[model samples]
Target: MKISRRFAGLAALLVAGLLGTTVHIVTTAESADAAQTSLRAADPSVLRVGGTYVGVQSVGDNGIAVRQASSPAGLATAAARTVFTDSQRLGEVWAPEIHYDGGRYYIYFTMGAGANHRMYVISSATADSGYGGATKLNLPDDRWAIDGTMFVFNGQRYFVWSGWAGTTNVEQNLYIAKMTSPTTATGSRAVISQPRESWERVVGNPFINEAPEAIKDPNGQLHVTYSANGSWSEQYCIADLRLRAGGDPMYVWDWYKSNGCLFGSNRSTMMAGWDPTLYVNGPGHHSFVLLNGDINTSPPAGSSFPLMFHAVAKGTPYAWSNRYWYTGSFMWWGAITYSRANVPGSTTNTGYSIKFFE
Candidate 1:
């Protein structure tokens, strides 16, 4: 049986404790969305460094956990082993993202409870295999931060994450700052995007804008997709921010918020597709591996992008513990607009559309 090489990379890594037959993402919509595995882990991030595949997650309240695979296909069977847990057990350690650059691997995550939350990083020569002690990332103002992710744009490295503006537990806004090094962020943080759209302000205690992920398209548009609304609400979904042309990356006015969530609750009718999961809600806090064939590692032609996120199963009576890991095969249609019922004029090249695989 011929299987997709791109889909194979994420299939194994997400199935940690479950058993499943080999499957691909190119099948009918029914099989695609039905092919989910309940990893029961939050804030999943997977990175392929050379031939090694490493995944980091907030498996527990104390610290970061890791699972590795020697091959992309081996990710399906790799077992999770906690690499870092707070000895002091300070607060809920959530949204740990693993990134690689300059021959070193870095894992950035949040530590401490509520207002005391701060972004921290730990690195090893390898990908968290020999991870050392955690070092608090030095951000300007040292505000409460979480879900720190790093990306290099225009030959300079930059850091982005969800953080509070002041000392209060007010709204969480998406912020960008220049990173002098992977472990430290330099320059003042720029509040690029926040909860402004009506859909973004849906279920709010403090109006959310957390879990910022950076992706750059072929057009040089630095796209930052963040989660909006309350994390536990069924309205918990993914939204976008694109750095406009001739715009400075660090400037707040340079970024334009997209019209809607890339993928929202099935009840909201964001993207058009068959509902294979019975009830799928809160698809946010994701990590994406784009098989663009130029950077990182080259792949065969027709390789697709993989977006993995945690989502709650049912909408009514939203429960935090009910969230599980799910992945979508991201397709790029270039200049063609996706002809979906609800998402008219949506282009898969920009707007979000995915085919779940079983």
Candidate 2:
């Protein structure tokens, strides 16, 4: 498998974490102006087209912004030509990730409020035309699900999302199922990852393992990154997992996780009541993009890749406006395998310690 096109874009996310290993990462713009993307960022998602960064984000209750981000940091500032709006209950429509497949653009987003929140999709031939009429997927295990994303492996389409294990909300877990089409799931969902780590379960009662994003390494291994903890708190962070070599993705025994959070809270120098942007908090809900070069070309060992995400200035409430978009680059350590998936999760099949930006 080649790299994810999502990785082909510029750094479109801001994440925080210090994996216990010597990493050759270039993380800049650690401090950013929060007011820029304010109500526009919550679950920020974008795709790079040529030199332009195109994205869709929550505008407000019942609204969406089909945005042309001027830069990774310049969301909400760019053209708002691509958008979706409805008076019908879209209650805090969040995590709008855009993907292009078969020469078409598809926006996968979460809509509705509370338990009513579920994933939906809209498409347009070109982003300039704007997406229309959100449609929910016919999922077999259709419970409370959100942050749904799609990936294709060996020509087979698959859907991964964060959902409640039961009817009532207890905790959010990562699930994968076969997708007959972009808008339909064809089989029972397999539970892959959950909030088993203490850092992942920090407060908000119901722990989270949301925002399952897929990325491919140069070696053709399949891996996914996810957000952990509560988004409402500064404790919110990012973690990841990978499929075992030659392991069946549908089986719970096929996936493994890192020892700890791959991306979490950024620790930086601070003064008393430091600039909110100076020390970012809870860098999560992000997507990956290949910094440069052709997506099909296998980058040499230790090539730097960019990432972007929404973050709040330190000491600020986790409000919509407080959250801003940030960008940076990190180097990959190739396919070097040292540590193992020492952490616990749904499967006993521990994998090689898969590190991101290390």
Q: Estimate each model's TM-score.
A: 0.79, 0.78
lDDT of 1 by residue, 1-358 (tens): 4344344345433442244322232222212343335477677787665456677777667877777776333444578777887987788888888887777778889999879899988888865478878898988889999888888877788998898899997788988899888887887899987786777887887999999878764445576778888997777887667665456888876666655666676445353322223446777887774332112231113444555677776644567787776755443212212221332222233332233332
Give the per-residue lDDT digits (tens) of candidate 2, residues 196-271: 8655666557888898877665455577778887888777777667777776777765676654565556322111
Instruction: Tell me the lDDT of model 1 at 242.
Output: 66
lDDT value for model 2: 0.64
Look at candidate 2 and tell me the lDDT of residue 247.
65
List the lowest-lDDT window of 10 residues for candidate 2: 267-276
Instruction: Give the number of the best model, judged by TM-score.
Output: 1
Task: Find the 10 residues in a row with the least total lDDT in model 1.
Answer: 291-300
| Model 2 TM-score, 2 decimals | 0.78
Query: Per-residue lDDT for 214 in model 1?
Result: 80
